[model samples]
Target: MAVAAVTTKRKRTTARPTKTQPTTNAKLIKQPLPAGLPREWYETHNRRLKAMRLAIALLDTGIYHPANASNRRIRTAAERIGIHPPSETTCRMVRSLIHYAD
Candidate 1:
């Protein structure tokens, strides 16, 4: 008498799904205006005030001197002061204020 051969198949395991991390963009996100400032200040005046203050601070510290006039550095300073760096035309206005303040 010959006995029949028995065969067995192994069961495959499935991988578990992983949770994905949230992606963040480098663009600045808008924040609500501070309470001390008027609501309209965010729309019109606060940005200019912050930019001028930043520019004046740089001039006071000799950061924007002719020998070291760096638009990149100025932009960084403006950002630190919570103002988006001015466009070329607005930068010209900031520069004029800088000149007049000296």
Candidate 2:
């Protein structure tokens, strides 16, 4: 039985489906007002409180806070803040900041 199992080879007949990412239309997603912020704020704003706070901290320390920054968290925060998706350059900058953080 062991010899037969070792001699046998299996070939895949169909390709496995790759992981699909969730897509959301910025227009469709609901933006909730964060405490102390304005209703129209999301319309004009791009960054979230955490990102804004991080930006402030970065200005003082000249570094990003690792604990607060994550790719998903940043996107999620932005979605909550509203406006539209960030540019590729911005995303790259934020991700790079994460590495320099902590």
Candidate 3:
């Protein structure tokens, strides 16, 4: 005796796709840094800012856990957010920021 195979059809939705809003190109006003600050301090400050931006971008993209924020993934997020590609150190900083976020 031969057995017959059965197939099931999947249902499709007729909902229309919504248009995504375009991103704004607003420029941020620069604040002057205080004089006499060490060069390392400036570097660290910028690194922290970039990391924070990356962390927020990742969070916006549904990556709430730091474990899921690998370097490549973080870089991709940065690209999506229109940021320059971050360095290895900056990627680590972004993960740390995500880990410490409440």
Instruction: Tell me which of candidates 1 and 3 scores higher on lDDT.
Output: 3
Per-residue lDDT of model 1, residues 1-102, tens digit only? 234334555666955443342235334546575678777666456657655776786787676543353566667767766777766655655666666665
For model 2, give the 10-residue run with minimal summed lDDT. 18-27
* Model 1 spans > 4 angstroms off: 1-50, 64-68
Error of 1 at 96 (Å): 1.2
lDDT of each: 0.62, 0.53, 0.85
Tens digit per residue, CA lDDT, model 2, 1-94: 7999999999999665443423343334465758787766764455444445444444354435655555555565457556344554454566
Per-residue error at 23 for model 1, in Å?
48
True-structure RMSD, every candidate: 15.7, 12.8, 15.8
Best by TM-score: 3
Evaluated at residue 97, the lDDT of candidate 3 is 88
RMSD of 2: 12.8
